[model samples]
Target: MAKKKSTRRPRARPEAADAPPESANVAQDFANLHVWQIQAFRDILLVAAIVALVWAGYALRAVTVPLLVALLLAYLFEPLIARLSQHPRVSRPTAILGLLGTVGVVVVLLIALTLPTMVRQTTQLVTDLRDERVLARLVELQEAATSQVDRLLGVFSKDETTPDGPETPVTGESDEESAPDGPIPGEPEAGTTGPPVPNGPAVMTEEQVRDLIDERIARERARVAEAEEGGAWWFTPGTGRVARGGWQAISRMIGAVVGIGLMTFLIPFYFFFFSLWYHDVLEFFGRLIPESKRPRTLELLQKMDFVVAGFVRGRIVISLIMGLMLAIGWMICGVPSALVVGLVVGIFCAVPYLGVVGIPLAVGLLVLEQLGLPEAERMGWLWVVLWPTVVFVIVQLIEGWVLTPLIAGKATNLDPVTVLVAVLAGGSVLGIYGMLLAIPLAACGKILLTEVVLPKVNAWTRGEARDPLPLN
Candidate 1:
């Protein structure tokens, strides 16, 4: 064999030689695929790609959220940059830098002015919530509620035919006979600080009330203790382990803050670049679409942009204005944590009536704060309730009549009911971001339904073969 090392290699088996290569067979099969089959495969691939992208976005949200926020800011600020760049002296880059610098300075001023006070108030509020003062107030309120309820029941128990008499709790003779010779069931013990408890037919015994409060307190304390001793890096201060864990936690916290700051700082750069080359980016994406589809696609995107821009930009301005109003109003009314509460309410107000919840929250906080104070220093519940209510009412009136009409306009054009439902649905599915986006998304959906889906459905019903319409 070596002597005659054949110039040619041995041939394959006849069957193997006759058969086409696997790749060629695959190609032939692919070529033979029906049009519908090819379309179906493409659709499946598109769906798979979309699903993969969504999964990746969810998995990487910690990174994606900040980027998305930056993108949103860029989108919001692009028009300003464009307008500024139209001036003879201002180049696009210079416009971006100037605008970003102005925004940065304003933000710094606001933070410097409000952040320390907000932090101090917010910390004090949290501490008050965690302590016994709030719990004691809650108990007193519960007792008062129980007493009122008991009185109401007793009035109903009395004969209706009898003329109205001095209101008194109806303790049946059996209850009085069976009662022990200790202190009355509802009377305050000596040295008690709260309102004198109603003496008569009580709904819940003092022991029962005390036990309920104690149980809740115990559970809360245990939870706080568990959190303090959690498997987190930090632990209660004592040993080397504690020091090491504390350092680790501190370092991690610092790293997180730095990461956030860096991300925030980079947003301006992102905005600058995005604005500078916005047209280039648009053109690049436009090239991907078929020539026939490009105009329609661009039109649809423009419409979406209009809707999103109107809602988002208008809502943000409105929210900021409303928040400022609320903060000032609350501060003027002597509400504790006014800045924090006002800011929260303003943010909530971005979603229409969602801010109504802040009424109860404000009322509760005022009640708690007042109840914690010395009796002489405490504002009556009437004023405590009225101040916040009046502030909210005035702010709402201003917003309904002025700010909304002026700033937000009729961008979404959705009914209040629809807006509420959409917001609730979105919040349930995707938390706060969902709530914020829900209105615009619903509006967009409505447009799609009206412009695209309905027409197709009507055509189908009439047995007409309408060409698949582009979104626009």
Candidate 2:
């Protein structure tokens, strides 16, 4: 009876008993935040990280661009190596070396055969743009054209003088002879001219202006030649950077020919290694993904492989055929620098819709004929412009109707609008290389979102049963 009475005396503390579950589980609650909880913060952090990474990549582009280009080129040439290896007595390494050697020889021959013409044409273009005489000729033509138009409209009337100039024949050659010859009398030339002209600015004739421009161009070209021996493009494990001094440094950095040559030399080596090691490399990367995600990851990888193999490799083939076609057409049409233009257009056409830009560029180069050279040899317009269009259209017809179907086979099923946006975005982000790489990356993204992301999301919403791989 006494022990039962004592039970009522042992009462618990109300504060301890009344404590809320939320306080005890504060860490777990924070860790277990749902997608809706603090979602913006998480998303913002992720976006910031991605942007920072991209900015860093761009900042280090001199290093990264070459590596990426090499990797992609390796993908493009892997099949060729495979085909070459299939022949009896041809090992993989031998095939790689042989194919590369053949490519190098072909390239050297092309350059040796066509470089003089390209150089001559380019020089002419530069001269026409900068020379006052050429510009004067252009002005004369403009005035003549305007007078003709005015007469047609009767705005000048029969009694009126030619618009903005003395009356002249339709050719309007008078102004070409009208440039004043002597320095104006009363003005003093700046700096001493032997004895008299020290107080005023120097007088310049049209010829003098043209000469000065030519001198400047020559000097700049000399600097460009100097720049060819300039600094390294990327850091090396054992070597420090070459020091470049003066304004020439800026030009050298931009022109960096030694770096370019190094990269060119390195490409074949890297390409060979990439093909040689691709399986090992792929396996290593594959092992990186968690076992649970391997199925979807492998699927996406296979999709990317199809695109790289069919589209990227096939583009190289298409470019070669198209370029050869255009080169032959331009040569037949007598277009100057036909080889160079064809080569450039062919290379760029590897990019989707880039052919549009390439075609216009080829046409503009043709129109450079309007500037003509020294009253003698200004011959880019015969069928240079017109025939390129024919070549382009015929190539396009064949490309669309036959080549793409047989070779690339709709590897990139992206719509034109999507391709355009991707190209623009790529260019804005990383320039020419980005433009080159954009479509394949777009295809990868589309595959991931359509086949992986959306399905995962829908399944999650429905709380579907899973078939996750067994954990390692």
Top candidate by lDDT: 1
Name the regions of candidate 1 deviating beyond 4 angstroms. 1-31, 34-37, 159-256, 457-472
Cα distance off (Å), candidate 1, residue 241: 13
Q: Model 2: per-residue lDDT, tens digit, 73-134?
A: 77777777889889999988888789888989998998898789778867876786688766
Leading candidate by TM-score = 1
State the lDDT of candidate 1 residue by residue for 369-444, as single tens digits.
Answer: 7777888998876898899989999999998889878887887778888988999899999998799889989998
> Each candidate's lDDT (Cα)?
0.84, 0.75
Worst 10 residues of 1 by lDDT: 231-240
The whole-model C-alpha lDDT of candidate 2 against the native structure comes to: 0.75
**Weakest 10 consecutive residues, lDDT, candidate 2?**
232-241
True lDDT of residue 355, candidate 1: 85
